[model samples]
Target: MARVDLNDYVYVNARVRGMRSHLLTRDFFMRLVEADGFEALHALLEQTIYRREANEAFLLNPVRPDYDQALTLNLIAAFRKILDAVGGEPRRLVATLLSRYDVQNIKSVLRGKHGDATASEITNILVPVGSLRLEQLEVLAGQREIRDVINTMHAQQIKYARPLIDAYPDFTKKDHDLAVLELALDKYFYRDAIGQLKGKGTNTEMVRQMLVGEVDMRNISTLVRIRGVRLDDGEVENLRIPGGALSADEFLHLDRLGDIVRIVSDYPDPRYRKVLQKALAEYQEVDLVAFDRELEHEMTRRGAAMSNLDVLSIGVIIGFMWQKNNEVINLRILLRGKAMDRPQAQIRSDLFFVEREEGQAA
Candidate 1:
């Protein structure tokens, strides 16, 4: 076969664009808010883009499952189908993006095992859209201890399993270990796989900027959460992941100085600036969940905007993937809203709009 070329991206992007169109618009959220229960929500989804998965899941769960879980499984299937269709460099590229899912699953396995959660609970929480198979995660979840999961991962060349293995001995602080392992995995994926494209010309810089900015925001969020939880300096810095725009020292310094506002005030990067501002504001008034969702929305908006650009590199692909993920989240929120009999207004407020204006709450 001829080498994979940028030409293949055209086909992949085309497929992604079509998939993107099926994502619920802001208007759709407004309508979904009126849904009465899981059944009503299911009816709405069946008429919309989630029809295929909704139909399939309804048969399995019979009674409506949690909206988010149903939505997640559906989205994973859709992503898988798209990957299969655009099988080539397109597949490889998206695989890189989804690798984070494996990291997340591992984190879940560790948490579940530590908390004595049942196998079903862990399996339900896992999103199998990444390099790791769902069966693998299921197997790990069945293990009596976390180390067994780590051993299972060794076969896949997912070196992240090593840190989890090493950290298990001192796993008394479960949250700290999870954070450290996740940060380690995030840095490893970028530095080893994505980061090597430091100066490959054409749109690579923009892509790199987005990824690095994302890591920076994640680190900042982590710092804020740790501080909120009253973690001491030693514990906080130990949890810091180093591949972002800020050095480990700088992240700690910024956190110590109560300098979040100043740090984000004139931030040169637009993507990071918007997110930093939202995070700063939310942290002041609300809880970490609000700050996290706002920051996440900011990132998704940036990725979605990048996808629409005329650039030919992976920008569009990244944007599409981000948007798809958002779709899954949105559906989950709607389902939960319906199940709880929450008012439409309240549910709508929880939806994250990537393209939303900075001033708009939803």
Candidate 2:
């Protein structure tokens, strides 16, 4: 692939900035939390960039299952628009970043296959914004066994297949545990993304830092979540990915989840340390979910700041993508909460909002 030039990103950045402005506001989410049901929430969504999706979902209301599919379609449509707006090497770089969705879709397929999910059920959850097309993922979903899926991926020469194939034995030994396969996929995606961004340019450096931060956050969250499970130190070590701010050994010896906060405090990245502290403070008063939301919001905030610093580079594009993904995530949580009849307070607590600083808010 050709390297992306900073100058080549100018037009795309301007277009993305315009699109970013249309992202749902914090107030809109507050209203969503108070929504009576999917109908009300869908109406609210119709007022935003997701209007078309909301309308389509409403038309499919009798079927209902298509609601989730509509949201996924909207996400892919948004991504496709962004991808279409750029050309050449810049588009390739963006595709590399978006390929994380490919990783996600593959993992969903493997898990569905392992659990004997019907092809329609698996197709409903698969995201098609990455390298793999929807039809290809649907075909993978139709496979009868995890091994068949892996073989198909390999026969098709998919880049992601190599890691899963190498880990297949461990997965089989672990009783087809999807977590093992998932960890392998996550590690490969992060390493592959970092490799692509390596030595590209100053523009790529900004995007690289964002990816590194993501790896660190994932490792930290994994450490916290796995503490409640029965996994031993070695098992935990196997789950950790390299190339983050912290070394694998750093997380291997942690005695408790709180120790992760202290490790974050000592991290070389000051922004991470600050976010960890804030998250820790919130965690004490509320719950671990609060901490997770804080960490995510802080990362998004920093990405936005970086985009502002270098608007005509990959940073802006990456920032917009992060914000776009967050929009979809927050909507999913809200829509699912409504569908499940969850409490307003609980759903509100679970949301990750993108709040502008006091002066910045119009």
Candidate 3:
């Protein structure tokens, strides 16, 4: 008999490919852009796969924020849909990738608490699709202080808590600087992921490459961001993530160049060089936010490209993850545009259009 993992992939890959076919297409977005208003847009969405969550959102508050909540729930539902469909090593890889959601939830909660946001405000921002249960995150958000949040995490035995706990002193030492702690979590998540995916195999290597790609872009983004922050020069070294096309020496060397455009324009690598070119061309000064967005778009584009790989490979799951994320974000943006009564052309300009390969219709 074939290996058990192969058996799992036969079913899992079929499920994923089938789901990809049903993802929202350009045609759907065009209609969405032409939607009359928020209610009309919600009405259109309710007629599709989002009906359940859209209805739940309507029942919750019947406004933009609640609709946003519904979208968040819907996105979580999408990931769970795939997770529930797979088993064995395929499931492990999926779960491993899903850990990023947990990291994001932690960051959202910490940032929200730091800003004195309401509990609901924080919870609404979370996707709750990772190992950390919604209740656990809600409790974390409910904590009065950031340290208390970290402490409660330990009390609850959250795996990510230890790193934050270890870094808490530095957080305090840096005058309660959130970036220090946030960077610690980033390092922990990526390092732990790379560590688990250490073995050699085609599928495992694919996932490793996906992760290292993230680390590379994030390190670059971090390096760019440090220029605007008050942190010590050592912060770049501290935030470096190993095993990407960009090296530590390259990162440090680039950081010292000072001019954001010149830093990227003169870089040796054509791949990363291409990514920032468009965004840099539009910037008169450093716009880290734009660079970050450009980087995220590039990553998603590359991750989504993996769907073209072998059917039974982990690429399907990885590709779906990225595309699904883009789909939801695009939906939210399109609806927001409709709500604001923006013209179709303007809204279309801002949306991330997912072009299908010639014969592949959505």
Q: Measured by TM-score, how close is model 3 to the native structure? A: 0.91
How far in Å is the alpha carbon of 361 misplaced in model 3?
5.9
- The parts of candidate 2 lying over 4 Å away from their true place are 1-7, 35-41, 62-65, 226-236, 253-270, 282-290, 357-362
TM-score order of candidates, top first: 3, 2, 1
lDDT of 3: 0.81
Best candidate per TM-score, number?
A: 3
lDDT of each: 0.70, 0.78, 0.81
Locate the minimum summed-lDDT window of 10 residues in model 2. Answer: 353-362
Backbone clashes under 3 angstroms, per model: 0, 0, 0
How do the predictions measure up, each by TM-score? Answer: 0.84, 0.86, 0.91
Model 1 global lDDT (CA atoms, 0 to 1):
0.70
- Which tens-of-lDDT digit does each residue in 1-362 have in candidate 2? 97544338877777777887888888888988887766676677778877787687667674464556777887787788788877777877788778889998998898888888899999989878888998889889989998899899988888889999999999889887888889899999999988887565777777677888888888877766666577777777888888787776677755244455655565555656667788878887888887777878877876766665665678777777777778788878887887788898988877776665444312
lDDT of 2 at 236: 75
What residue pairs are clashing in model 1?
A: none
- Residue 322 in model 3: lDDT: 93
Please identify model 3 stretches exceeding 4 Å from their true place. Answer: 1-7, 63-65, 228-233, 284-286
Error of 3 at 90 (Å): 0.7
